[model samples]
Target: MSGLEGCWSAPGQVRGKDATSVLRGEWHLGRRYFVLHLRSVAPAQAYEAAITYRAGEKPGGIGSFWMDTFGGLYEPSLGLGAVSPDGFYLDYHFPDAAYHNRFERRGKGWRWTIVERAPGKPDKLFARYELAPASCRGTTFTF
Candidate 1:
């Protein structure tokens, strides 16, 4: 029943070969639903988004809003993710782009591959990371 509520960080990030992102969140578990506010951090960039999930057998979907280096803001983006017993997939869609990604947990972290499909040719990307230490102390909340 672990959704997006906890203060989680991806300790490892690949360099130019991949995009690395870290996330922290404040989650509220309701009688039958859950909501989370998450922030992503990287070398020189940061963005925030909100996610909502309901109590169910499966991990629910997601929604996100973020800013880019181009001084552009993207909102109303819809997405979904699920972690299987041995693997995981995260899919995101924006106005002009769509991304499908799959990952498998490695020894201490996860290895990820993503396909960015746009109006033209689709591109494949790869990355690997070994979980690093996270300082999310006193940053987790549930209501």
Candidate 2:
């Protein structure tokens, strides 16, 4: 996961697309987690958020803490993830809402996607994040 440390730009953002978002993070809590910050801006709206990701006690699972700018929208959600041979799967299930996400390796970069599912319904893609290396962040996202 050390490869995850650094600045990442979304697709079509090489020309400055704050609306598309730019993500950056570093490790914190004595290497317990990678503290991430994201900023997004558009013509009439803007958003910012932070996330903390930590490896779980076992080999297949991970945990995250998230908080965003939305007023009480997400507040702080504790998310869980599982690792596989190809990539990682994350599920963020809050009351009345559920999201399934995937972070898969794509060459030197990564592909991140999320989908929302309602009870007895099909999954709907909420967002897709294509992260590519923008700059090296020292050595690791380590604290």
Residues 1-143 of candidate 2: C-alpha lDDT, one tens digit per residue: 56677788765232233347667867877887787676663536466678778887788788887787774866688888888676777788877768777778999888877778778777777777788887644423211
lDDT of each: 0.48, 0.71
Model 2 clash tally?
Answer: 1
For candidate 2, give the lDDT of residue 56. Answer: 75
TM-score of 1: 0.52
User: Between which residue pairs do clashes occur in model 2?
Assistant: 27-141
Question: What's the lDDT for candidate 2?
Answer: 0.71
Winning model by TM-score: 2
Give the range where candidate 1 is weakest over 10 consecutive residues by summed lDDT.
62-71
Clashes of each: 0, 1
- Candidate 2, residue 33: the lDDT equals 79
Local lDDT at 105 for model 2: 90
